[model samples]
Every structure is written in C-alpha cells, then in structure tokens.
Target: MGFNGIRPNATRKEVLEMIAVIMRDDNDLEFKLDSMNLSLSISVVTEIFWVLNWERLSALRFFAWIRSSKCRRFDFEGAKKMLDEMRQMGCDPIVDTDNYLLSSLCRSDKTDESCQLLEEMQERNCLPNPLTFEILIYHLCRLGKFDLVHEFLDRMISNGLEPRLTTDAAFIKGYFNSLRYEEAHKYVVDSSV
Candidate 1:
C-alpha cells in the first residue's frame, strides 16, 4: 500500500511500504509517524525487521532510531503506570531505567514528582547515580529551587558522590540567572576553601 493508504490496521506489506517511503523521504521520521498516528510497539518493529530480511547491523540501526524517537516523547504518567505494572509482575527495572524516567520527569517540568520518585527509588534500595543527581540538580537550578538543590547536593556528597563540573556550572549559571550574585560568589569562595 502507498503512504496515504496506510492506516492503524495496515497489513504488514502496507507497513513495509510506509517504512520504505519514510526511509526514502529522509525527512522528519517522528513528524511523519506523528502525522500518521502510528503506534508501533517493539514487537511490531522487530517483526518489520525480520520481514524486510535486513542484515543485523541495519536492523540494529532501525531499532535504535525507533527507540530514540520514542524516548523523545515524555509521558510521565504512562511511564509511572508501566513501572507500577512491572513491579506488580515482580519485575523491577534496573537503576538506569529509573534514571531515564527521572530525567523524563525533570525534562517535563515535573521536578517535584521527580523528587518523590527519588524517595521512592531510595525506598526500593535503588541508589541514585551521579547522572540521576545531575538531572535533578540541573532542573531544580533552572527553577531557582536553591533549597532543594542544596539539600540534594548535601545528600549527594554524603553518599560520596562529588558533583561534576557541569553541576558546578549549573549552580553558577542558576544563581547568576536569579540575580543572586552574592550567593554565587560565596559558593565559589566556599568551594575554593
């Protein structure tokens, strides 16, 4: 089937044609997918790969592209629900998975929810890594939430995790953006000490 004829219930052959058209366009894949309202799952994607009879390397690239596209959309409630379901199935995701969700929450301006997730992570014995701390601190700084920033910084240090230079830069930029020059200067001086 041609691109215009493609629908939600399109046959495998039609989906293949749509994929071919998308690849040929070399334009915005996400936009095309969005316009088409295509809801492709991993299984369907893998099936497409097998049907295409592509080499392993090509299939890997396609899979990565699909995953990246999906990751660009932040659906916090959907993610949380999926996580809850995973837990119910006695299948806890790894720390990295939680970190990804945390990053998504932060990016979506749900920093407060992200903080609650951090607490949940702790309760689950899932220790937050440096990236997790960085994600929270960066977004909190953007919001000028210095109190929570400092609290997390202290907690990070207590856990023997030194902030990255990017973290330091975030603090400086955040304070300067908020016109808290004195605090920024003090932070610089104290760090030197």
Candidate 2:
C-alpha cells in the first residue's frame, strides 16, 4: 500500500497487516502476527524504514516531495510518529486489544486517526479475515443488539465478505446467549456445517 507517495511494495503478510489496520478488523491480524517471523519480515518494506529514520529536516523534505507529487497517497509518516510516541510511552509492538482504541476513535469521528491506525497495521503486517467481522457481529447479537448486528452484517455483505462455519456457530451461540432459542435452533439447522 503506497501510503505517502513512497510507492513501496508490501509482502503478502504486510498486505494482510495493512488491511487489518485500515479495516480495524482484528482476528486474522492477530493470528498472522503470532505466526510470522517479525525479525526478518521487518526489513521487507524499505520506505517505511526510511520513514522511521527521518530527522526533522528530512521529514520536511519528504513532505515537500509528497506535496509536489500528484498521486497524494495515504502516507505512513504521521502514523509512524504517533506509534513511535506511543511505544516510547510504553505501548507494546504486538497486536494488542489496546490497538482497538483506533475503533473508538473511529466511532467518535476521528476518521483520520482510525485510518492512520489501519495504515500502521498494514505497515506492520496484520491481516483481518472474515471471522474478524463475524466475531464483532456475534458479540453484538449475544447482547440482543440488532442495530449493531445489522450494521456489521450490512458492512460485511456490502464488502462482499461471507462468514465461515465457525462464525455461523458463533452467531448461533450469540442468539442462545440472548435467550432467542428458537432463532438459535433455526440457525443451527440452516448454518451447521
């Protein structure tokens, strides 16, 4: 993902991560992070390495280059800065639930920050999979919150994503949690693998 006119190519894992950051979808990102070799993978993207190494004057130079460039892509410098600051303040580098603060910032209308978080996730190599959205939707349904479920299901459908069997089970469980046994049983019949 060419954030900031840098035009760097991300690895498969990196593409997965960037998507996670952009979407704020967590499940697959976390799973991939645990399996990858972060040490070697870190070197896969050079522009990002340059972004982290920038001195103030160098950063200004980068900004000038981006402004003059017509592409005007999603850049990662600001994200690198904020993430670096957070790390200095003791945030862990791994994909922690704390990262979901990006979602809250999103819900509260901090669209830019949310996007920054997603970009950062991409830089680090997190992949958000279908189960990710399913997990969120299932939890909402467990609480009998149709509005939230409706919102996520719509988002998933509109995005052309579908849930897996395990995710279908989660929805059934969620319905059972909400004491909607009839509905849960109906889902069990239609959704069981």
Candidate 3:
C-alpha cells in the first residue's frame, strides 16, 4: 500500500490476483508468505475462500483449509493430517466453507460420515446450529430412516425447532416413495387437521 510495503511494487488488483492464485493453490503458505510477506489472518482466509467460490473446492481441500486455520488459531486437529500440517505453518481455514461441506455430505445420504465430520467440528468447538441439525435430519428422512426421523423430530422439538416445510416434505416424499400409502395419507390428513 505504501512505500517499502511487501506488495508495494504490486498494484491493489495484482495483490488480489495473487491472493486468488494462493487460494486456488490451496493456500500454499510457503508461497504466500514468501511472496506476499503477509500473515494469513481469518479475514484473509475468508476472503480467499469466498474468492475461490468455496462450493467449487473439493471436500478434502476444503477440510485442509479448515484444519489449517484451526491449527493456526487454536492448534486443533482437522479431519485430516496434511491439513494439520498446513495449519502448523500458518493457515486459517474458512469455517462456513467447511460447514457447507458437511451440509453437502449430509444431503448425500452420508449421515454417518457426516457425523464424523460434525464430531471433528465439535472437537474444535464448532457446535452446529439448528440449521445444521435440520439438514442432518432431513437427509436422514430422505434416506428412509423412519426411526431416526422420529428421533430427530424429538430432538428438534426439544431443541425448539418446530417441524418445518422441508421436514414435512422430506417425510412425505420418503413415505410416498416407499409406497407407504397409509402413512403418507396419514401425514397429509394430519397436516389438514
């Protein structure tokens, strides 16, 4: 920005372009540090993730960033090892991006695996909110986990999240697809009631 700044020679646009490259390159700390002489802060990481269109990043790479940021911020372990290494050197990953990965996994009928990821987040003190629980429960329902569906309903009620449109729709769709006409009609009738 000013004289003798690390990026003094680079225009603001170029600096942003460099950051974009670093983000796409998986936040190669060595390259970023060596070239930019800048520390990777939470803000920087967030900007990078957003610039990269967080949704486009692979789950593994996204986790890598999360783990990296965690390790940098609090020395927490990510869901993987290499990401921890990145954090060791100074990488702060984007939490929202990581949450999106969990959401995607939950929607994929990989609730068990998603649970593992959630556990990892919890270990890092990242407790999911109602929306996360809603997604997990909805996916479970879509996957035909009737028992778990009821269990989640109970949990959501206890958590003070009333059954929502998506929840009802998922149940209706699953019941209909399973040819449980009686149960589906019951739900429809109950909705009317």
Against the true structure, candidate 2 reaches a TM-score of: 0.36
| Candidate with the larger TM-score of 1 and 3 | 1
lDDT of 3 by residue, 1-193 (tens): 4423333344456548655555565546444434554334344445555555554643345345444444443323223444344355465344564566666566455677776776676676555565656676667767777887777667667756577777678788889877887998897898776
lDDT over C-alpha atoms for residue 25 of model 2: 34
Residue 1, model 3: Cα distance from true site in angstroms: 34
Judge candidate 2 at residue 155 and give its lDDT. 64
Per-residue C-alpha lDDT of model 1 across residues 1-193, encoded as one tens digit per residue: 3333424455666577656744554556546555654555444654565544443223333443444444465546645665565466454667777787787788789877999999999998889888889889999999999999999999999999888888888999999999999999999998877
- The Cα local distance difference test for each model comes to 0.71, 0.48, 0.58
Residue-level lDDT tens digits of model 2 in 47-142: 332433442122332222222221122223333444465455453344432244443443344445554554555565654446546655555565
Q: After superposition, how far is residue 142 of candidate 2 from its true place, in Å?
A: 3.5
lDDT for predicted candidate 1 compared with the true structure:
0.71
Model 1 ranges with Cα > 4 A deviation: 1-71, 87-91
